[model samples]
Target: MKNPFARSSRNGDDGPSEIYGYRIYMVALSATWASAMYGYDSAFIGGTLELPAFKTSFGLNENDSTSLSSNVVSMFQAGAFFGAICGFFFAEYFGRKPVILGSGVIFAIGAAIQLVGKISALYVGRIFTGLGIGSHSFSDFGSITASTRTFRAQAQHSGEFRPRWLASKNQIVKAQKNLAWVRHLPVDHSYVVNELAEIQAAVCQELELSGEQRTLVQILHECAAPGVRNRILIAVMLMLLQNLTGINAINYYSPTIFRSIGFTGTSVGLLATGVYGIVKMATTAVFMIWIVDRFGRRGPLLVGAVGAGVAMFYLAIYSQLSDSFDRVPPSNSGSQAAVAMIYIYAIFYGFSWNGIPWIFASEVLPTRVRTIGMMCAVCMQWLAQFIIVYSLPYMVASIKYGTFYFFGSCTVVALVFAYLFVPETKGVSMEDMGVLFGPDVSILAVKAQENYQEFRRSTAMAATEAQQEKQGGLHVENA
Candidate 1:
């Protein structure tokens, strides 16, 4: 198989035919900028809270600081909760790119508002930023899946861009060009014939099973597919586990975590967090491009869960053994080790729970319910995140090192969850999900097998035709 990351050669013999090319990869990468910004903002909050100027401006001191900091983080999450609620409308109205771009704009404005140094402005700004971030939650991996399926389906049907309805000739040509770019095919490439046919076949199969005339309510609530329900449950479970692991608690309170580990100076804590941010981004990059597909989702998640548990356990133990939460550690080694363990936890998180939930949710759902399913999953994610962020300060103040104990326990549960429920979605195409998760795979498996067989036949037929044409040209030249 040709490597999916590389652009297909013009000769058609150089790249993996089974995978996609640069265009698709570019689209996938572009979509992740939303996630990147989300990480940046989450990390930014911790560093900002550590700023003496920020604390003084907000009238914060050690006595009332934890409550104020929690409020700031919680407010962002609260805004995100409603933003997820509204994302359905935003996506339907403006589409994915617009929603993401708009979110970036809103987030930027919120950041600008925060620079003004007032609590009211800061709360309002955080809400706007949350709305933007919440809006982006819908545009993650699922958005890429939807776009790929739709573009391929449309390109297959529209062939050479004959004007449809009110669409102009220029519009038709532009659409054709764009679709060609996405598929990494020349406008008239013969390869598109098989690809389109396969997409159309899968789509027709789904419509037949799902029906074309059902009302939206019937589609969402009345459908009875054990596989579909199972898939949705997996997504929800993953999202729940993601928040329960306390990754956000760490992201939203890295300075506090650092402080608890005995970093007395705010600058020192912030500097350490900046390094943490770098590690997170680098790990996330490696996971996205290589690990997720290569290793599959379940194993990494299990490893990550177990790894996080160990790290959190160490942190919890070290914190418990320490003299005080607010004072510098009597021995720097234990505190330094605790800080290192946080970095280790981030490594475990980056490769697993960080983005796999979105990828799995997108991959596990059939086209019919993908939008609604993703919407609900993201909403749950934001809501869970809100609860975690809101409660973290209290958890820290009341229980101290016990916060890590709670998250460590959740990681153990997460391992079980992954083992029991999470299916391996590596290299699975969007349309084949029904077959993968169907009530009786023995029956549904044939559908995918038949589709593959048909695709193979098409490839062979095209190759034969190309060979014949080449031979005919040789004969004509001799004559």
Candidate 2:
């Protein structure tokens, strides 16, 4: 059979390719390890802090232990905030691969330092680790998704794309191989020819409209462009909302949350918390693989907000009615119900809010300023995370069951945010995002996708005809 991407005398029209496919998963799995590492490190502290041995080893049970534990738990996030800023400069100077490699090395150094078994040393280690993780996270999450989507989308429209981080010959060659892998074809294939032509046309059209600017200062200014600015707003809000949902409260202080609900003994609380992790892992897998692209980002976020809010509301009401005013209640049917509610909340969270924010941020920004914009957004995310992590212990102590109410109210507001601000990005090309979120977008309009897609196709066709005529004239002259 003729290659689907080829013209083959059939008028070069195969329509737009599928927005997502197996190739995306293959590329994502192979490339996005920093995301997984970040999750592993973040979750490790939750169960670790609960360990009696760990407490003894770190002298965490000594005087002012509560404050100490909070510090230990929160220090990483503090460091991550600064690390995100460092990431912007690192990417600016060194490019993407060096950032990845440097982040890994720094994380390893921090991990090794933690193994020395001294609390003072661990504190220093955690900061370095946080720095590494924070630096790695912005580049890893932003580049893999944005670069992949932008590359593929541009590939579908233009054919060949020069990567932003082609610092050397080796990097350029690697990028070409990666692109070929994403296309699931040999580099020299006729399918590649058509794709390259289309991509070039799109690039040409874009160039005619704006001059290229490569300076870091200029790119930083580009971050203020209306389309980029709006996306940055969306990304920051989504990330802030993500933490405000209180996922970190559950993650970092699960034993405390579990104990507050009903479960007695560290083992019981940890066991229940272990179950929460299992459920999260399972459901997150389902969402990441199946629901995200199929169901779209906005819908799941809306459903997750309402469902999680309801679960938290149940927990709050249960705690209020069934428990003592000053301390945690004993294990009863209501506490059991609260435990179940926690599980339910996890289900809602795992299916949507957990993963969608990163995806949204990755797709929303323009390629030139994507890393800087994401660095700013990820900094906000870490700041939000730090606030929740550092403050939750105090909030739970002061307000008791009222903490759930606080989180629940936040989720309710999140519902409004998703409905009003979150755009459905499924199947939309990166090139089209500016137009999608452009000033002309009407808040009342239900679907702007079809209208804008038709416009892009018409423009692409005109650019393609111009390219073909140029190539034809060159061929005749050479002959």
Candidate 3:
């Protein structure tokens, strides 16, 4: 079978060799640990906070324990929210590679501090970990000393992508060279030159459209501009709706809920959780690799949201009818269906809400404000998560079935938001994003755009070849 990675998806581009594909995959594998770790750390930390020794060490009684536990677990998200904003400004000044390294340092220090086994240590550690995770993050929950071998190697391998994004302040000056470096082409290669021009045009067009100075304040100001503000709002809303999908509710609540549904033993609950995670991972990989580019983002999002919403609604209805908060013997069809719905939610959420918002946010923004704009979007994401996590317990306790209904409702809203607001970015160019959002571009238009650009480049290349031959003949006649 032919390797997909070896071929270019974009028109007028090629040479994405197997080695390049492998390297790109490694970078994603290493640096994109934040999303996975968010779940891992929350689950582990919830257990940690519940440990008797941990409570005693913190000098907490039951009354204060719940409050303190909420605070401890939520501190990470709070830090992550601010960390994203800080990382953006930091990334702007320092560059991509440095911010990435700094995030590791912060996360490592945070992870190490938590081992001190004090409440203070936990607070600081989680905050730092959150900061690390705010940017170029790989969340390693294991021992930091041992990490020097494994995660460090991953980080080093991930660093190979540095040239592709490191030059922030001087992006234009270095764009051609960076493009050539990644594409494994000479700077003069037509492919590299053409892609570089697209990038440059994108940057220039954004600047011209905004007519704003390239400062942190000015960029934020530009975001308030009519066109930019609406896109930013869309990104924020998509991210917000993503968290509202009851995915995290399951992340934090599933053990208890699953046990309630007759998976009562610790081992059984863990096994159930493991399977859920596996399902999410598998489906998400499928969606990202096979579905995303082929079918486009909107269709999968609508489909997944509907599936998840249906699952949530089913659980809500079952929770009401079965009254199965207390564990029963593992023999009821209704209870099993409730339990299965959680996995079903994971499958749907994993494929859609789990990944699409981030992709949409990144793709919709232009280079001028992409860093800070992403900062805002990511901040909104973490803040939404923190809000959901902190409020979820009370919500589950107070509303019970309505909790699922709330998430289910959000999914319905997400469907409408996607249909009306989210433009298909599948074939859109960065430079044309303004137009795509403003005038509304079609998914099919990307092919036309690519064809036109290819023709334009081919014409330029042909003219250059003819001119070079003429010059060569003139030099020979003079000689």
- Clash count per candidate: 1, 8, 0
Judged by lDDT relative to the true structure, which candidate is superior, 2 or 3? 2
What lDDT does each candidate get? 0.72, 0.74, 0.67
Candidate 2, 314-350: lDDT as tens digits: 9889877866446667766777778889999999999
CA lDDT, candidate 2, residue 234: 84
Task: For model 1, state the Cα shift of residue 288 in Å.
Answer: 2.0
Give the residue spans of candidate 1 off by over 4 A.
Answer: 1-22, 143-177, 184-186, 193-201, 222-224, 440-479
> Which lDDT tens digits does candidate 1 get at residues 106-153?
888988898788998999989988888888777664654433333332
Which is the better candidate, 1 or 2, if ranked by lDDT? 2
Best candidate (score: TM-score):
2
Put down candidate 3 lDDT per residue, 292-357, tens digits, no spaces: 766777777889989999998998888766665543635578888887898889888888888887
Give the range of the ten consecutive residues with the poorest summed lDDT in model 3: 138-147
**Candidate number that wins on lDDT, 1 or 3:** 1
How big is the RMSD of model 2?
Answer: 6.3
TM-score of each: 0.80, 0.82, 0.78
